[model samples]
Target: MTWNCGNLSSKLATEEEYKIYVDGSYLDGKIGYGLVVLKDDKVIDELSGYVSDPDAQDSRQVGGELVATKEAIRWCQSRGIKRVAIYYDLDNIKKWATGEYKTRKPLTQNFKEFIDSTNIKISWHKVKAHTGVKWNERADELAKAGANSQGATKKNGLVDDLEEKAKKFSDYLQRRGYSVNYKGIYNSQAAKLSLDDGFQDIGHLNIYNTKKLHLVPKYHELRDKSKQSELEELWQEFLG
Candidate 1:
């Protein structure tokens, strides 16, 4: 355990004794990844970051953890923590971290940079979360705080393609007189899956209040098939 030695403690941290535990919490109902490094119940380092809607199109936490995990790796490396035992509440993170999911979030060059430069060795462990494991709980709190931080939507104009896509989905919903709220996103997604998995093409979906409305994509297709009018000559009509 690091005593209260102020700034000197960090510089004097010995490699053999520099053990760290890493974990993350993504946005609620989404993956907001967060990690905390502890040396005998004392916090040496922590990091939290998220992947969220650019236009606040929806709160998609699962995707955000991919971004967070990348950041977590960078965080660990910057601090010179070479020997790490990374823990996650979700087994999927372990799977993704250890290369079980091949088609996981696409990594940027910066991600590759971290991977190539590090002598850090990461070992993953799955912990029983919300079970009062002191450091784990602290990690949860840290992750939630990061996930909920105010950057869910920031228009830098650099995100040309994604912004366009998000806007297209936004415009489609608006034309249908449907407004986006948390429940609406899920309901829309569920209704989309009910139509075809491509229903998520509309945007993030949440079915929290699905009973109140009938968001049937089949109905949309039948009623507004003309929306497909912009298609090529082959689809001038359904059977064409």
Candidate 2:
């Protein structure tokens, strides 16, 4: 099923239209999706869950988005909403949805069918990611929470709910009057935590830094082995 809006003009939706923000979170072997339904800037409901045992071929970041989008359509249809807008942060979604991109991926093809079948006047809106948009940020946090709940890692022989930890750490920062960025990490010099505190609060930072380490094209491995500080510095530099 495709969006067959033959004569329906595309434009920014208003407050009267139901709005749903969807985001996906992925880890080593798990995927989670978060959805927030809203109207008039007030939340109507939220939904989140992990994709159980996704096939290796379908267990990708885009797979999570496809699942979430498919469910969002069903949710809107169930509500009998005549007009709705579904917001996502991925540019790739636009390409796929608009028929500008195609692949043999089962999930993508299946999602097209799902969209074509849903009976609702819908529009797709792509938003800038991790920019602190309220509902979008909440959806992201929910996705992370779902991921942690489903596939929480073992640390010191105990289950570590990194998403929950991230949420609480973000709350602490807020209570301390520290401005938390959309990624749930504070970047302000005045509010910045020490390296130890940073790692403790933002567990994903270590993952991100570690990923950067592996992305090096080799030859500089030794020099960059001790450059975690430099990596973070570069991240902050990018943020600026």
Name the candidate that leads on lDDT: 2
lDDT of each: 0.43, 0.54
N/CA/C clash count, model 1: 18
For each candidate, what TM-score against the reference?
A: 0.44, 0.56
Single out the weakest 10-residue window by summed lDDT for candidate 1.
187-196
Q: Would you list the clashing residue pairs of candidate 2? A: 1-112, 1-113, 1-116, 2-116
- CA error at residue 215 for candidate 1, angstroms: 42
Cα lDDT tens digits, model 1, 1-240, are: 011123533443442344444444444554455667666546777766444534222425444444445445545543545555555566565554444554323332323333333345555555687898776777677667766753552423223223223333332333233332212122122422111122332333322213443322222333334433232221223223
Error of 1 at 101 (Å): 3.3
Model 1 TM-score (2 dp): 0.44
